[model samples]
Target chain A: MKQSAKLNTVNKWWQYETTASQKWFQFGLKDLYYNRGLILRFTRRDLLASYQQTVIGPFWIFLQPLLTALVYLIVFGRFAKMPTDGIPPILFYLAGSTIWSFFFDSLNGTMYTFISNTHIFNKVYFPRLVVPMSIILTQAVRLGIQLVLFALIYVFYYFIFHTASPSKILLLLPLLVLLTAGFAFGLGLLISIITAKYRDLDNILQFFLRLFMFATPVVYPASIIPDKYQALFWLNPLTPIIETFRAAFVENGKIPYYPLAIAGIEIFFLISLGLLLFKKRELDVMDSI
Target chain B: MRELVLKAENISKYYRLGLIGSSSLKQDLQNLFVKSRDGLTVEDPQHIWALKDVDFELHAGEVIGIVGRNGSGKSTLLKILSRIARPTTGSVRWKGKISSLLEIGTGFHAELTGRENIFLNGQILGLSNAEVKTRFDEIVAFSGIERFLDTPVKRYSSGMYVRLAFSVAAHLRSDILIIDEVLAVGDIEFQLKCIAKMKEISRLDGKAILFVSHDMQTIRNLCTTGIYLEKGRIKLIGDPPKAIAGYLNLDTQLSKHTYSSPHEAPGNSYIKIKRAELENSTIIHFEFWYTAEGNENLSIGIMLYNDLGQCVFDLASAPTRMENGLIKGACTLPENFLNEGQYVLSIAFIGDQSKLLFDFADCLNFNVQDNGKNLRWYGKRVGIVRPEFPIQLLNIDRDGAI
Candidate 1:
């Protein structure tokens, strides 16, 4: 029996076809582009709702990094007697905390993308990538606020103490931010997909992220890592980005070209692998959830 | 030739029961070792087919109703069609953009104001920001929540939330619209208005629709064609009435004369319907033993429904003071109230001011045989109720009629 007849030579027809062994490598760029408005709205919603009902509202965004940096200054610079490579403890820790917080927030937020948004994901079909992408963008806004705060402090120290001066490497600030965001987003996406199936990964993710922060040069200057362990430090994808960011802002800080190049290669691979896994799992992940 | 809007070919889905994560990499490696030793692949016994070999076609402006009992793959089909879930097999091809309201208020954040949520939800449903801005007033007006538009949606009543969500979904300008049972959320008035708007869009705007609903009356009223699914396969397809009848027939076939004991019965702990049988294809006899607990104001009600899922008539015994024991009660229907067709009898226990305690839907099924009163008529009866009304023909002067 002729159950259904295939329409041939259709003009402008959209086909939704799938198979058991389908392979997809293309990032759903078209879907992401079309739903860019959703991404922006989601980002706005996240920003608005994050601090709702709080007494200070968005002041928490700036206050969080400020407080964190102060704690790091007292604990690491004042008590631990860690060397700051001639950079002021406040300046060094503030710069590190600001950049590190962006990476941490983006990674941690996107890491729960599938699990936290299961209700919306199960009911609706937009690009699944939109959720993680929106998460990164939302973190970008917080990063912007934190950067302004950092800039204010840097200017104060620059004129008052006449200690730190900007370098031409500061021109690479955009590239540094991109590298950090790319690495965090990629790892977060990969972890989110894994956690969707194995929920135990979610439990481990927080502990891992905390440990990872210490592994990178978030609390102390990269110059203090000692000469022998420098290579091991650069093994982490975040080390070069954070070191380069500090180099851009602080005098005597160095941007190691070889380490930076290796980090870039690693970022590309991590992001590509993350996208591949995300695209493959997104179709059937809801059922498992 | 009219344009084809969507075509689905041999779609199927399989689901595995039990823990999803237990089948981890370690388990897979163990399975591989076992397979290598045995030289044969072992099948997981916990797997069940949610949908199997389903095929259908929809055209522009066509409305199709999908009907089935729970776990019969109605939701599975909708998920695949909406692209929320991928089919395990087969392919679906379509023309033009498809917008699905599988659920209303899918991504609505409680902290966002109603106005903000509208734009957010609109964009999520595939509308551009400019498009949403242009239709902003109309959406708010349709939702009838203009006074509360600036309030956070968490503060809005559930009805207001559903109304706003539905309004945004209604304005989606896709070529095909997929709706699940979201209309069941709001009040009857809002539901009616949504149905009207959907009808207008399909009829005037020429958009195809695939509606999944358990409300048979709504399906009968709106759908031109229907698909009845049973056990993950299409049991019947074609005209809405015929498909509905076939679906009802499947119910009766499963539950014929009597209900089993409490352990096997399809009821709750408060009541265990022991036996339900139909007599003379007209009178319904049912017996249930209830544990009254402490309340004495318990009454039993039975509703009879036809094949179209419309309740034909209902009968309720007046609330009687009773003790906790095995209580027996039987009721008969009004004579000649039902037409010659299949009917399902559902029994429910009611307490104080008609609060439903337990409802056993489709507990008993019986067929009403035609009494040969319409032997001279060439066709079957056309309605659920067949009552003979006396008619008087008046033929006064036809030529003098002005």
Candidate 2:
């Protein structure tokens, strides 16, 4: 009665072959845009959490970092004779501390992207990339505050000594910061992906990042490293990052092209690779967890 | 005629037991055998399939129920289909985008307000902003919490929290919907509404729905077909009634009936007893499955054990109550009798005054199942206490027999 069911409906099948190089990028980009509201809420939450019950409110962003920078300038830069080029000790330490803080903040927070956000991932299937990406973006706001403080410091010094003018190349400052962020984001996301599958990698990362602090030019300039080890500094991705940032703003306001190119390539590579690794894990990490 | 929309073929997942994937000698030996055989990995030595070469073809608009006991690979199958997890072997092919609501409100930001969280939760479920906005009003209307839209979800009542979360998931646009025990949350009215919505989504939208649940009624009401799973393998896959009958009747038919019954129980005053067996024989759960059948009293009998190492109480109310009601044969225990202490319970089917329906004692030591008061109160487990206390007649206007 049904015409032999399946035998009555023989069908032809055609295979579609297509390369989707931009598919992953589109996925990430679309996810980021769609979830912008969520990132916004997280940003506000971060601000609120920092100064929820404080008398001074959200201004604590500037006041807290300013206080710390002042303390470091007094204790380490002046008292302990920690070398601070020709710039005032306060500006020197403040500039270095603020940028380094952003790098470390993104890296340290991204490492826990899997463990800390396990609760969220267990219940829903959001692009897990959003977790670390949102964190980096939020921390960027914090770094912005430090930039404003630097501007204010520049003005005060300009009025007082008339010798603290930033070069026209200071326009490149934002690019340096962005590149640094890219490097940090890529590195953090990469580590987080690895740690999600094999948690033992987490312990090693904790130790490695600590050593990485010294390897980069956070507390000291890269010139402090001996000439032979200068090339070694190039191997550390954060090296070109911090160096370019400081050179464009705190130093001669010009990029060191060779090392900067190396850093840029490393960053782009890290981000793309991090995304691929994370996608692979996202294929079935909830099962393992 | 409906087209075949989904197919899952021979999927299995293996997990290492110890910390950092450290497998024991026994597990290793078992794995060695399975590997040499190339397709023999199972939780049970006698059974070789954590989801045995499972094969099923789902037609468009089909509502399928996956019924399985604990560790039966129901959740695992859902995970694979949802793409949240992968199987160690085999593949799942589906016709359209899939959105799996494993648990509602998982991605809700605690600090974000109800409205803000809707956006977040919607996006997490794979909806774009424009789509969420279009359905935003409908979702809020469905949740019935418009007044508290601006209030942080942290401040919302537990019911309100689940309502908002469920609304977001239900509004997802994917054509293939996989839900895992979501109906186990929310109030009865809300749970019924969710099931209705899910049914509507499947029926009207022509979506392929794979629903996982322990509630037989919901499964019967929602599914066109069902699959019975045991030890990560498909036992039966066919019509809902037949599949459920197979699953419901599986535990009642094992050769070596295994159960958790108190060995040497005590008398009343925080007593517990349990007796699980196959047929007329004793049960050893670690060895084999068990089956049962009987008269009005034929059921999972239970006895209360006190500190003195003996059963002081024995009762079987499920069948007695069901003789005059809809629940035909069920094994249940009243909540009021279970005290807040460690008491072993015997698994048996008995009547009033310790009338032994089938007293197979010393089966396995069982403790009182913990009933959490948090969000889980919405499950079928709520209101288990059916105590009939003789109250002093205070003041009552008898208005009945209408």
DockQ result, candidate 2: 0.23
| Residue ranges of candidate 2 with Cα displaced over 4 Å | A1-57, A249-254, A284-286, B20-49, B250-402
Task: For each candidate in the order shown, give its overall lDDT on alpha carbons.
Answer: 0.81, 0.66
Candidate 2's residue-wise lDDT over B220-298, tens digit each? 8999999988778888888887787666552233333323443343222122323233321222222112222323332
In the order shown, the candidates' Cα RMSDs to the true structure are: 10.2, 11.6
Chain A fold similarity by TM-score, each prediction: 0.92, 0.83
- The per-residue C-alpha lDDT of model 1 at residue A160 equals 92
DockQ of 1: 0.41
Instruction: Please report the candidate that would top lDDT against the real structure.
Output: 1
- The per-model DockQ list reads 0.41, 0.23
Top candidate, metric TM-score: 1
- The true-versus-predicted C-alpha distance at residue B127 of model 1, in Å, is 1.1
Q: Which candidate achieves the best DockQ against the true structure?
A: 1
